[model samples]
Target: MILSWRKKRAARRAAKKQNLEVTSNMELTIPSHFRCPISLELMKDPVTLSTGITYDRDSIEKWIEAGNSICPVTNQVLRSFEPVPNHTLRMMIQDWCVEKRSYGIERIPTPRIPISSYEVSEILSGIQTAKDQQDAERCREMVLKIKELAKDSERNKRCISANGTGGVLAAAFKTFSKVPFEQNVALLEEILSALITISPLDGEAKSYLGSDSSLHCMVWFLKNGNLSGRRNSVLALIEIVSSDQQKIDELLEIGGAIEALVKLMKEPISPSTTKASLLLMYHIVSNPPSSANSKVIARLTEMELVKILFEMLVDCEKSICEKALGVLDEVCSYDEGMEKAYGNALTVPVLVKKLLRISDLATQFSVSILWKLCKNDKSEGGDVLVEALQLGAFQKLLLLLQVGSTDGTKEKTTELMKLMNVYRDRAECTDSLDFKNLKRSY
Candidate 1:
């Protein structure tokens, strides 16, 4: 009777375990909530559902707040739109890999045409021989051939099935970088003319000007030529740098580029020229060089460049204001003296007023500048900064923090919070008039 009772308990336990396993498998088999309306594929990164709903993985938790999750297909409220979970996905992939490995499945086969080092060396030697002989026509042909080889090499460097849309642009930069200085200058002129005449090459030409090669050429021009050459090079560099948002860091790194650019910004020029110079100046100021020289900062302030930047922030042209604010961001990075000069220039109020009046890129830029200035720990614009906060600046910044799509705006939001926290802490510690009530509204 004891043995029979033990057998019955073991059987009951095994049945319960099997039932649980079955239930788990059934849960996993349930279909996902919705498919993409555009591609009909499972919703992936930047997933947008029907009823105009969208959520990235990072924001999905916030999006799911208040439990309003709904089906994209029928617009019916969903209890949950939980995905398969990352660990489950990883297990699936691992299982797939194991199965493939067991079956001896080959994904990427070995290349049929392997590169021969000896053949490459022979080709390089011939090219060198042509150049050594000073055979201009032969060398030009060799250069063209070498460019082709470089393109091939670049193609091979990328994944086999990867997109090659940017490859041509990359190759152009590579080839231009290797050209002699004289040839490079001529090429720059050609590219500039091409940009003016051809719409198709406009993007490519702009990219070429911003390339490291082009920057190197600008450095060469700055060091080797007269004042006029330096001015022209700076102007050219400014034009290229202002065209694309991604090249800002590379633009800041050129040798003596910041000082040269600041000099251009200070010189008296026509409104259009000044606007262009100011635009570049703003980018330089907002982004700042990785390393800045004290002398450069002094010269910029002495030349009244900071004041000019302040003026540009309130300029009639929205584009100019936007770029100037970008520069103001960088300018505030200097020591306390520079910060005071920046605050005394009435930059904060101008930016606050602009934020109210302009709602475009200029306003966004102005808000970014204010965020930087007010947040700086050493900033001396006490009443002005507080007034900016009281005048709805903090709310504007918070809104930007909440909705901004660009990485720059996101970073500005984070910095703004840090500064506000410092202010909050200071307010708590001191008998200084409690602007707490005022700041809270913001």
Candidate 2:
């Protein structure tokens, strides 16, 4: 490896001495205009940004996809990322490659024209035509074409997502969902695969996707479909419902939605699946229709969500732990829910461990959860109090006070300290306290 590295470095030095163009380690002596600004390589698919800078399609597309709004070369904020292909420059590069074959340069093949919105419109129209003619084979073929288009290039995926393909596919999903799953499995799968590729849908696309029939379709998949399908359903629903109370109510109206969520939580198919499901449930339970939140809590409690949350909290990631804690805090607001929370052997210990350990939000939720538990425990040598004390909950609560928290969390911590301090020496609580950090707490 060392010898190979030395040989390559020597070759690059000789190429510079001979005045051959060398931008990359591979030492391709290409013209300046033939190389992409972002990748600084021979442009196979050169695309010009509105900023008048050309970059390789894959490189610039990745930049835009990562949420960069400024052109890489110009550093100007992009109003829109409608990159046009530099066909003339591409031909020049190809011709130069052919002339330099003896120099070990390969001719670049003509790249396929990116799928346009007009082509996408035609494909959508063909699917509608097939549906109207009751041509199942033609409809499936059209849908499959769309599925393939979504995978062809990032450019194509953007076209399908932004140029009304999502809305068209959503309408088709509703229609195909009516057909028995066994009968329309292929067609439905194709539509869903394409939609998922371009999903977290926006504008009128999500509006159509939030339909009742669509919710039912996703719920069916959540309950009966394969792991991949179930995972997509959860992910799709995350975008569909968002914070829309009406859509959430419609999803809740579907009989099996929450039940399927619980079942999926129990035997989570994948980590992303589990996180998405937790996020969806948090949204649903937290935003129940006005006057119906209590009922929502009761429903979730009956589903054993408290137990599920306790199990999930054992050494989970910070974000997942934060969400689970958020939901558990809400569930514990119900009288029976709080009892079930600390009642679990794992709940109190997990709560204490995460008290000051995770993010500020998780710490807030953990404090709320522990406070609820201790407030409701009136028994002598209360299990909640004793268990918390043995786990060093007494010292942790004191530390939390000095570490600074939201006023509400600090108040709750102070309350918990007072409750636990009764079981400890009066001087012990104040003796070990870090007065400097405590002074900063004020």
Candidate 3:
């Protein structure tokens, strides 16, 4: 009996010790460095930022993808979006996971980036060689490969773009301009697709692209290429010229850039493509034109841009309406653009309907457009006023005053009301206005 009791006690003590060991293991604290700054959890894939801070790749990528330019840990602007993988830190985390596996920690495998720096550099070097050797087939294959790489992931897109992809491709374009446009459709499409995959092209790339050959190449794609090619060209132009007046003038000097853009807008392949064209138009026309570009405004008039834009304002959703009105407002700032807007039968009604109905931005643009049309109408004793009064614009302007608006918008509203004060009794109108609890983030 004594021997059996001793054996039972020994077994009970062993079980208690094992339980204590398990409890201690569960209480082990994760090191600060092992934890991601963003998630405050053990990192699965560690990467070092240019700011010299480490974060989990997933966390940092999510931050970057959200359009943040600053590092979360350092609170400093990230010089480069590229995050170098910290293999050592990742391994350390993996080892810790293994050590705690009995406590339910799972070891993570090695994480892969979209592409390595070496791979990107090699492809770029090959592209340069193909361009120099005038190997059209080799160049096409190389560029298509790049497009495929860009499509792999956003990280790959940034990786290839951050390298010399744009410069080399620009050089390729300079060479390929000698090729007949019809023959190089696939090649040009691939090039633009690759560039577009990494949009907001860096300054170096933009400078490289801001040349006669590049502009004319995109113009050809815009005018003559297939639907996909056309959309890609316009999107490429938006990233290329952006708001640079000099580049805009150069693109204009290329002759068919504006015409091709306008034509695409008229016969759009899709809503997204049409929206892209509108953005490009806004970028080009909104910027101050160079002294040598006197015919820019007249060209817009000749293209019937005002009617087209008003039509877009009439049919498009709130997002597109805002873009269309933004471009239309800029176009109407000039005498020629104003002449086009004036001739449009739906101009006043559409502008009035857009007010307070879309967004503060749309309403502001509509107000400016209305003010211009009204001022332009002063010669006819404000036909714009009569139309605006008929469309209940007077009540909307009053609402703008009551709800409050930007100083410029308010001033324009007051002026419009004053201009139309004499015509208020001429037309019967309803004062009903519902904001629908519309919220604006701007």
Candidate 4:
């Protein structure tokens, strides 16, 4: 009986020791497993699961809120926990943004053409070769080829350079002009025909023929061809002439070209076409050929070019009206003899009408032309000046003068003042009673 009791007591002690060891291991392992990898802290706000596993609510919430529900250490996803802490995740995102901003990194859009050193060197070599060649015919052919290859290169360079367009056109013109006379003529004709056939291409090719080169080409065609043969060719060429005053003067010197352009203007066409033709005619007439001014003026007056110009000035199309006024401005700059030839055409009344009908620039140009007419001190213009004052032209002129004073239209404003004084002085003795008052009103 004694041996049995002793054995049972010893078994009971061993069982208690084993249960304690198991409990101790469980406590250490559970707490360590639930701890956050990032925070490296004991888990808090403990939560129990169906699988008999327990985890801190704060740690699980953080894991889910970070867009990383998986535990970093064990790689076990903790998706079955309670709601994530949104406020904490927002703070973390803000901190991440601040860290990125401190690095001075920015996302920039990429450019279309990423030019490199090798490509640039190749383009420079081609340009130099094109520029150095002396044979115009060979150079011309090469230039066209170079232009095709450099189209993209030019586009990329234009982003960083201002003279890119001029540089390209200059290279092309130099090549085209160096060809032999006969060859150049053929090339010019080809260019013109191409321009006509592909009307849309003209806008892009305009820079190809520099204004000076185009003027020379037109003169060449006009001088080489018979009057009838040249008529249509010159008419087409007229559309390309630059509106620059010097270029217009140069073009007017060509034989028979002016008359051809004037005839085209009189025909039925679109307003833009008619306007261009009229402008060319006006420049030609105003500048006149250097020699035999009287003969040219007589022919021009007989042709009634002044009447056509006045009618165009009153056209409803704003562009037509503006261009017509520009033409009138040029014409009135002619010498006294030309003015006399124009006197019989009754230009002032039409000009006065333009003043009220057009916009500011047109009005300014028309008034300028009127001032030029009066500056010649002709008796016919004196009568017109008196009529103008009666038509309230002086009042509008004075108002423009006042506005011009503040706007710094020094030249225009001074011209207006001079005109007002001229009208006042000229109309003093006239029978027009309004002019007499206008003389005193200012």
Give lDDT for model 4: 0.52
In order, candidate lDDTs are 0.51, 0.79, 0.80, 0.52
Candidate 2 stretches with Cα past 4 Å from truth are: 1-30, 37-44, 48-55, 58-84, 87-112, 179-182, 288-292, 426-442
Q: Which residue pairs collide in model 3, if any?
A: none
Give candidate 1 regions above 4 Å deviation.
1-191, 194-256, 268-272, 278-305, 333-343, 377-381, 386-442
Best prediction by lDDT: 3
Ranking by TM-score: 2, 3, 4, 1
lDDT of 1 by residue, 263-324 (tens): 55555445555565666666555443445444445556765666766654544566556666
Clashing pairs in 4: 136-178, 136-179
lDDT of 4 by residue, 1-442 (tens): 9999999999999997887666545533223443444465534334433333444444554555568755554666555534332333333434443444423322222223323345545554554565465444554454343334344443334321232333443444435654254566544453344333323223334444435555555555645644432443555555445433454545556566566566656653456557656655655556545555445555665666666666555445777778777766665565643464245434655666666456776777777777766556467456656766656566666666666533433465466556556667555432221222222110
In Å, residue 98's CA in model 1 sits off its true spot by 82
Per-residue lDDT of candidate 2, residues 1-442 (tens digit): 9999999999998977565434333454568887778788888989899888899888998899899999988899987787899988888888898887756678988888889889989999998887677666788898888878888777788888777877777777777676464677667667777788887676566776677667888888888888888888888888887846678888888888899998888887788888989989888877743467777777888888888888877747887888899888877877767767755777777787786778889989988989998988877767787777766788877878888998999889999988887777522322221113221100
TM-score of 2: 0.76
Comparison by lDDT, 1 against 4, better one: 4
lDDT of 3 at 415: 92
- Order of all candidates by lDDT, from best down to worst? 3, 2, 4, 1
Using lDDT as the measure, name the better of candidate 2 and candidate 3: 3
Q: Can you write out model 3's per-residue Cα lDDT over 1-442, one digit (the tens) per residue?
A: 9999999999999997898687766777889999999999989889999999999887999999899999886789999988898999998889988987766678998876668779988998888898788777888898888888888777788778778787778667766765465576667677777777767677766765666777788888888888888898888777776646667777877767788898888777898898899998888787765444337878887988888887666667877888899988888888888877777777877888788888999999999999988977845556778868877888899989999999999999999999889877776664433323323211
Off by over 4 Å in 4: 1-190, 196-254, 281-299, 336-346, 405-442
Error of 1 at 433 (Å): 26
Candidate 4, residue 181: the lDDT equals 45
